[model samples]
Target: MTAIKTEVAGRTAAPPPRAPRRRAQGLQGSRKRAGWVMLAPALVHAAVFLLLPMVMLVALSFTDYQFLGAYHWVGIDNFVQLMSDDRWRTALLNTVLYTVVTVPIAMAVALLIALGLNSGIRARGAMRVLYYMPQVTATVAVATVWLWIYQPDVGLANSVLGLFGLPPQGWLTNPNLSLPSLMLVGVWQGLGAKMVVYLAALQSVSRDQLEAAQLDGANRWQTFWNVTWPALGPAHFFVFVTSTIASFQVFDLVFVMTKGGPGSSSTVMTYEIYENAFQGLQLGYAAAQSVVLVVLIGVFTLIGLRLQKVSSDV
Candidate 1:
């Protein structure tokens, strides 16, 4: 009433509306609170499980913390020892070899499978489920089955070789064959998940662009390189990073199948860490190895990201 009288008498113009502005501010505040509420659980989990353990690991790396003995600060002694540790070197090399061999093969094969499936292949759903079975299966169970499959005497592999008039080969026992055998298993287990990612990416590719490329007389390979591949950039990066990390952290299969043994031929960094921490009781040294593994993973991931960026630019 006072505002109306003021407006009528022209004594003072009514103030600009404040309610809408205040309401909007209030709504924005509520939204922010809601977002934080939604994120709290994940943030807490990371802090507790990831960040805290990482901090402890770094701290432990500088101390000789054996499980049954008193510990003391050793500065960089553990890292220095790793420099001359032949076992550590062997583990690192084998791990790198495994990662290099498995990741690209897995990605390429998965992408091909995805492309085939995306083309409306018959029984596509069944095929996808079949391929994905290994991924969903327990790693221990998969490794155990593979263990039987790799057995020299009565294994499926040797039987198949016999059918081909070839002698039975020691798949896991032979130093030359152990790592490769593991690589095959790694690639096989990983393919389904990678294929699913690629299939989704392939489906999202622009149909109009593909048609345009076809109309321009581009061959299948040319069309794919120009239209489909570029669109899969995100998928490629995701798969590469994840596959690399998984490869680096591979342990269960080695533990179950090889035990890094017949010597250290099949040993990888993760297995080495486990051996040192548990079998050898060198917790500090194992922590240092863990740190190195983390560093290597970070470096490789960065290299992958850079390569992806360069490829995308090209």
Candidate 2:
């Protein structure tokens, strides 16, 4: 028996066979090749479309190259000029103000609409379609209709106001109200899409968790605050970051509705960037402003992430 045991032990497990190890090496190499193949198109796309343009924009921002310039380097003079201009200052303020006011209001309205649609309402399907319609509607067409609605006199808005014995006050014509009115239209357009997102997120919520809370004597508000809200972190973050970025880069609405007017009161960053680049033909300054817009959005998004942490923890 001792001899047999020694023989079995000395069989050496055949050194665990190098072929298996070689096979694993081959598999790993294949997986690496697969990953590179999968990434090749995306790499090409980023280089051609995104990275190249960004490099050009950065280069442009450092130069004195206007529309008809003999292309010379200026080294941040465009940026300095931007800081000195009160119009750009107003544009920055309006952009920030629009972002701060609209993102929260739009998100709140979207969340409420989601809650309503998710409560097993009778017309849930139709209601969802209704809410989501604005998301698919053409922005120009929507702006056209809103232009009518905001027409100050003989418009839907003023007509409704007159029913309450109020004067037909200027909506888009008043600088004080133009930005806010745009914010309102933006909210209406944004809420529809955000509502769909929230509804999808709300669907993934566990019925068991909700029922457990119910059994634990939690009211609807308590259950939502304790369960639903926490479960909505991903959707909340997505909606917020996208909406905040959109707010910063609001252009089409401003371009269509008021052309950044009520006397430049609605001149947001993107609109300002467009005006500088195309209208004023200050391409380098516009590039500088675009870079600033990018930086500003990045900083604000970072702040948003921090706030989301605090809110989620609570």
Candidate 3:
């Protein structure tokens, strides 16, 4: 009787172990499927929107899809047309040049403002509101105000210059001054947001580090160079990347002020793309120009990322 009981007990234990093994396999399977289910929406969005549209753009760039209601793939024709065209070349150059000039200057001014705001002066709150007001103001209003200021006579800008004994000048009419004038507005409108970002970053700097630097007899400039600036790595990276991208795509101010020029001086890539598609009625060509701009922006974004502490903890 004892031997028989032992045999039955051993058989029952083996079947219970087998049942648990099966249950483990079933749970693993369910987890794997749930993981895929969680990612389905993101995958669907990329396929339907981003991936599909990009694929269409590349295909359309090769074809003559302007207004003929017919598709004819002419390999490299669009690119060839773009390169041979002088106007397009000029517009491309202007875009690149504007990007180079405005990005650094805007970034510097934002840094200065950020430093000022961080220093906690009297009426700091009022000053912060003044800087940020441009962001909340309507674009049309801003442009209108600037137009009045830029007027050659009876304008605030010229009046101020008269106090300095400078001659009256055309801020927007002179091709040389038009781009810079636009840059001034761009700086004013953009600096506030970036300064806010930098202020947030400055607040996070380790107080101990700054105190220790002072204890070591480090001057304010030296302390900022070593501690404060390093803490601002992420904020600097954010402002530079976004402002550079925005600079390349500047159109509204150009449209409002210069309308592409006194000889195409203000015609950046975005404006050119607009002209080619809408005015020129060369949709395929415009798409190709857009492709080039996309590539250029991608290259700049990568460079900006590399310039900051994106990949490193420092």
Candidate 4:
């Protein structure tokens, strides 16, 4: 009887208060609510602007919408037509070429400039500002400046060529040189931005590892290749992806400089899309082209990520 009474008393002791646990749970719930509240604005903005527009674009790609009148669904006809469009093919090829040429060269030049800036060089701040000026400057302004530089007669480029006894070449007018001339401007414009990214990456490299490499009798190239380059992997991936996207979407320069001419030589995908959408009044076709551009960017990003993974694993 005594044991039973003791056991019943223990059971009826109100079982150690759960108020603390309840309070903790309540705090967590409140925190979650606060987090949601804080995130609401960004979520709403993305929903209304980004997600909605993307959905509209995809929907519009399937219809013959020309910004007026009743539009009928055309299914995949737009995409089918894209497959056979010569201008589309030319634009795609040009875009790919531009991206392929500019990205690596721009990255290399930027990395070199970053290295120079990161070193114990004098006036680095001033140099950095000078290099980064192009990035902050308006694209239209940059394009306009480059237009003057590329003039066939009495241009800076031709004048420099003349100094070396070289004939004055038509930088913008010639079909062969127009694309390359635009590429030179592209590289120059992109350098400052990529350099800034690399500078940040380089600054974060491990000093201890670098010293250890030096102590191990590793030469400059060896230390840099093994230590510095590996440390820059993330930056490399970032620069490559962003540069590729920018290169693929090049337009303002093409517009202000060549206008996709000397027989569509310097025509890019974005320029072609704009021409179709506004000039030709083929919104659906432009939407299809936009879809392709998105897909291409996605593919390139995936490839860069894969390469980064492989390099990291190695």
**Best model number under TM-score:** 4
Q: After superposition, how far is residue 234 of candidate 3 from its true place, in Å?
A: 1.6
lDDT of 3 by residue, 54-111 (tens): 8887888887788566768988899899999888898888888888887888778878
Task: Pick the winner on TM-score between candidates 2 and 3.
Answer: 2
> Which is the better candidate, 1 or 4, if ranked by TM-score?
4
Q: Tens digits of per-residue lDDT for model 1 on 237-304?
A: 99999999999999999999999986999999999999899999999999999999999999999999
Q: List where candidate 3 sits over 4 angstroms from the true fold.
A: 1-47, 309-314
Residue pairs with colliding backbones in model 1 are: none
In model 4, the clashing pairs are: none
Off by over 4 Å in 2: 1-10, 312-314
Candidate lDDT values, in order: 0.95, 0.91, 0.85, 0.95
Mind giving the per-residue lDDT tens digits that candidate 4 earns over 264-287?
Answer: 999999999999999988898899
Q: Give the TM-score of candidate 2.
A: 0.95
What would the TM-scores of all predictions be?
A: 0.94, 0.95, 0.85, 0.95
lDDT of 2: 0.91
After TM-score superposition, the amount by which residue 184's alpha carbon in candidate 2 deviates from its true location, in angstroms, is 0.6
Worst 10 residues of 3 by lDDT: 305-314
Give every collision pair in model 2: none
